[model samples]
Target: MSHFPMDIIESLRSISRQTGLPIWLVGGTVRDWLLGRPAKDIDLIVPERAFEVGQHIADQLNGTYIPLFETVETARIVLRESKMIIDISNFRQKMLEADLFARDLTINAMALPLNGPFEPAQLIDPTNGHADLSRRQIRAVSKAALQADPVRILRAIRFTAMLGFHLEPQTQQWIAAEANRLIYPAMERITEEFFIILQHDKAHQYVDVMDKLGLVRVLLPECDRLRNIEQNNYHHTDVWAHTRLALAELEAILLSIDDLFPTHGEAVRHVLKQPMASTRCISDMLKFTMLLHDVGKATTQSKDADGIIHFYQHEKVGAHQSRAITKRFRLSNTETKFVQNVIRSHLRPLGLLAERDHLSRRAYHRYFRDTEKDGVVILLHALADISATRGKSNWQTRRQNLIDLIRQMLDYYYQPQPNPPLLNGTDLINAGVPPGAEIGRLLRQLAEEYAAGTITSREEALAFVKQAISPDATTTPHSDI
Candidate 1:
């Protein structure tokens, strides 16, 4: 009746009609339907004989069945058309109360009955879910309900952010009291819920709750130390706050980028905007790189004789520290490698721009060699990182310049024109060259000259190689030092 697939609803209706039992489409699907959201999943509850009803539905459609619920009889049947698992459970206990009591939040507990044709559809409101839905409040049915599944503490924040609802004062107090209970939940479960929060429109609000609940410190203890750490004149906020701002900016920019390209036109937008889900955004590489980008500041925070602060070699220090942290988190070798590359090349954006005037072929080779597949990803990360900085140092002008340089780098990166080798080992070996370490060294020297665009092809490479090996090399490669 609500624009759901007619065949599937009819399948359910037929099964209910044959069984001679009242069936109610209960829980989230009904809730989401009332909220005017898409409801792909449906749950059906019968007054009695849930297993028999489930078996009947399965037989009608030849679908898989699974038995659940310890006290009340409950089973699941996969519908043929929608392929949705219609959870079939019995309405047990004296008060028709299990439906509301079984759910975490009041708004999710409402149900819609689909019984005999003569009987009108009834809205089951055992827990005052209708009132809560109207008020836009996420309140637990009872205190015991909150205690039964502590993960609702996190879900409450997620729902609050996603639905633009507010937690009742009592429910908020309960959440504060039960925040520690989240530790008992499995990491996989926590991660699933956390990602759901991230997917929401205002996920940062959920994270803010997590921070207030002290769960962020529990989740990412490494960042806890940044809370009070001073960041010198260059930073407007403390390190932790800066990190949070960066993450917020990153999310905002990504969402803006996502909006610029509609879902249907995503393929066409690839040439203009980098795909949002590239290794740069959601990968563990991004997470670890973001975490460690400022980590070396802790170790390298130094005041010179002039009382000026410097974080020299912070990138190098952060790379090693990131590895240790990654190992502790039980990340895979590939993940660690990616994170390490991001950390190591974190400073390359600034370095690249520093020498932008005389961009050499050798510099391009070195840049490509270091970044590999993550070249573009690292550049994007750098853009986000630089944009995140709160310092007032003409960064607006500098940031735009860096963005242009990165675009040019991306152009060369995607283009297929071959980079002819300046000098090959074979060239040295064929030129009556001695079989010594000097030959390899001389080959590298010739390659450098080629990278400087001083030589273009094999003939030029041969000439350069021969000149370097000649005895009158007074005006040498590393000259005028």
Candidate 2:
């Protein structure tokens, strides 16, 4: 209790005295407090009437009361001013020890009295949770804990990563034995936990641990298929290994983005920090794309007549596959399209590199236009992918080149357009071009010409459209454009 802020402790004590119900600070809140971490969310277990008590607490504190779980009689009191949340719930079992035993991890199976005077000695650790916490070990309360709730498996891994604790041998065995049950959890739950893992700085370490525990295959079969798939001589390792290294390198680059691209580092950081949908950050989405960027290679692997391995159009194939995967995870439409677009156009930056000298302003415009705000993300992923593939040979030059290219792209994207569309749809319609798909196609072509410095004014655009619509023109009008 001494670990908590005095205001929270006094408020809870006042609420307990008013309600005349014994309240206990339970679960993760207590665990985090003992570990000296800031706990924003406070969980309170009461003997009964959890919702009623929660409402009273909310009213007394002028907070908002929300019924979180009606059937379970759980409610939440949000102290908006303090940015803290108090969750009140009925005990799962009649006795506190029984409730603690029903929890997933031993380290979390502890509680402290909230009504009584603050005292560290009042902690109730029925499963030796204090010892485990001191040892920095993650152990299950019981063998059936994970079997009962498969989501706990992911939670276990998350805690392992978050707390920098190793799972006890017995706990590891239980996770391995119950690994198949991970599929039972809702996709939303799995996705939430997966991205949370990626949000950590050492996400690559946890991902490797998840792969070793056999959870990766269940979650991403496409990635699993790349396990032993060989690549060309340009790559030092298999696809799976290279993918892992790319993720690690991606983290490194993001951390050091300031030094790499000093001109656009702030913009890049802002884009990465921007929220995608509700549950994921742009950086998390980027990491996910990096992991799956080459998944299509497993299916598209081939050898030419000269025995040179080729993964032609793998990015195109991977984009389609990533859509299905993102959909399966029940990600928002925005997130789904973001991941798909990044996968599809990941190779574009490198393509730009190849044609750097000849690439027109229109080409850069079209690249950014197709990729949207995710263009920077794709550029960073490409840098990581190229670095991992090339290994230790002159990677600094290549990396610096990619960073410079990204800086140029960012500058181009942020810079004011040198040529806004010289002609719009209405202008095209007035120019004798019928109002239909052809008008839209002609408008795009005119804009492309404008961007390419081919046409500078409305006269040039009308002339181009007239020539495009003429019967003497040999090339057919591109409706798809």
Candidate 3:
């Protein structure tokens, strides 16, 4: 009642009163309301004739009606230009139980009346959702619900991460049995949930559950390979443990940086604090990249004679695997390329350093060309990835190098593109220079030299080009010529 937007409540009540149909603001909106969190989207339950009610609400509010399952009984109401969603559903006493039962956990099943009398909106304790919510326990409504939709198994992990709740024992068993069914869900759906976990502060807790329930094997079977995969002497944990720790550290780093720079976290932290959510700022494609970033280690891991393990050419191998995975997931071209770029250029820390022998100007250009604005993400991933390695590598030195590289790149990227061809080919042609391959090459060379501060004026550029075309004149000084 506290967190529910008064306007949404009044709108629902107006609809229910006008239609003579009972509607209740149920599900997450109510749960979040009780938790003192902001609830903008609405999910309403109608005892009977939900489709008619849905059509009426959309009409009355001038909203859009979207049939969720191509069924008139289940529809969504979208407020015009507001991005507010009101899911309307027909109440099937058994199916309502089934729907509530099918939800990943019990705490999300509580409901409140929309247009009924002044009495308190009934808690509707059919599944003991209130008790579970009070206990902060995520208990499944029924096993049949998990059978109906196996994706709920994966979603349970997300709820645990977001709410800091523990999965009930029986629900935990259900998840263990059906975790592999996650592969049956759409890749996009799996990736959607992945980000929610990454954004949450307690993301590692749910990831641990995912690992234990065998869901990691189904969604990212590559993770299973990392289990018991020991690292070299410098490491403190195995690959799977390291991966989860890395992700958790990434979240912490993002959080700490936000405290240091609030506006930076504005886009990412919103979904992190939500009970049920998806990523908004980081694209779904990038989430996939994060999910698969370490996958190649499963293939490239090796043990040397000295008992030291090395993942040789992991980045190169990862790049190939990422492309295949992207295609298998039916990703868009831009998304596929983005994932590929992340995987390929993930090992960019040393290259970002100012070491003259290691980093050429051409290499510097290539880094910007590939990473573009995602340089931040790449750098973040590098920091997280290396830290996860559990090696003796000095993070401070690495961090300083990264900071220097970022400052340099930002300085270059933000400035105007080197004064926009101070001497164009037209200028070259007008300077008694014949139009030919030499002219194009000479003009390009002159612009590069001018950009590097070798020449300042058009006269200097013209004089330089003349000297190039007449090197013989260096020996014979002809003032007239």
Off by over 4 Å in 1: 1-7, 46-51, 66-76, 89-96, 116-121, 258-292, 295-300, 311-337, 417-481
Cα miss at 402, model 3 (Å)?
Answer: 4.2
Candidate 3 lDDT, 1-481, residue by residue in tens: 5545778678778877886777777788777876767876888887667777888889888799887753437889898966688898876464555556556567777677766652334666568887787799888877877777776776777887778888899889988887767767677777666666755655666777778888778766666777787777656788778778777666656656565334445533443333322233443344446667777788888988987789888877878887777676565676666677777778775455536335433444456655765665676666666656556666656555565564454444344664666678787777767888978777756755554455777778778877776647453322210
Question: Of 1 and 3, which scores higher on TM-score?
Answer: 3
The parts of candidate 2 lying over 4 Å away from their true place are 1-5, 80-83, 391-395, 418-421, 456-481
lDDT for each of the candidates? 0.68, 0.84, 0.68
Model 1 TM-score, 2 decimals: 0.76
Per TM-score, the best of the predicted structures is 2
Clashing pairs in 2: none
Going through the candidates in order, what is the number of backbone clashes in each?
0, 0, 0
Per residue, candidate 1 scores C-alpha lDDT tens digits across 1-481 of 3555446666677766776667777777667766767667678777788888888888788778788875789888876655777788777544456757777888878777665441213678788887887899988877677777877777777788778888888887787777677767766556556556666644556667777767777656666666866766656787778777666655554555444223423432253233233222243346435655777767677788988777788778878877776665455566677777887888887788877887756676567756877776677677667777767787677777876776677655554543555456776888767778978777656655554566667787777666666787455444310
Task: Give candidate 2's error at residue 361 in angstroms.
Answer: 2.5
Model 2 clash count equals 0
lDDT of 2 by residue, 1-481 (tens): 4446568867888878776779998898888888778787888998789988899888888789999897779999998678688889998888999999999998889998877766658899999988999899989998798999988998888998899998888888888888899788898898988888898887999999889888899999999999898888778899999999999999998898898888778988999999986867899989988899998898998999989788999999999999889988898888888888988888888888776766667877688767877887888999888878774577667767777777887787776554556777887777788888998777766666666677887787778888887888775432221
Q: Which candidate wins on lDDT?
A: 2
Q: Please, what is the TM-score per model?
A: 0.76, 0.90, 0.78
Cα shift from native, residue 341, model 1 (Å): 3.5
Q: Which stretches of candidate 3 lie over 4 Å from their true place?
A: 14-19, 62-72, 80-83, 93-99, 115-121, 201-205, 232-234, 257-288, 302-308, 352-366, 370-373, 393-416, 419-481
The Cα error of candidate 2 at residue 452, in Å, is: 2.8
lDDT of 2: 0.84
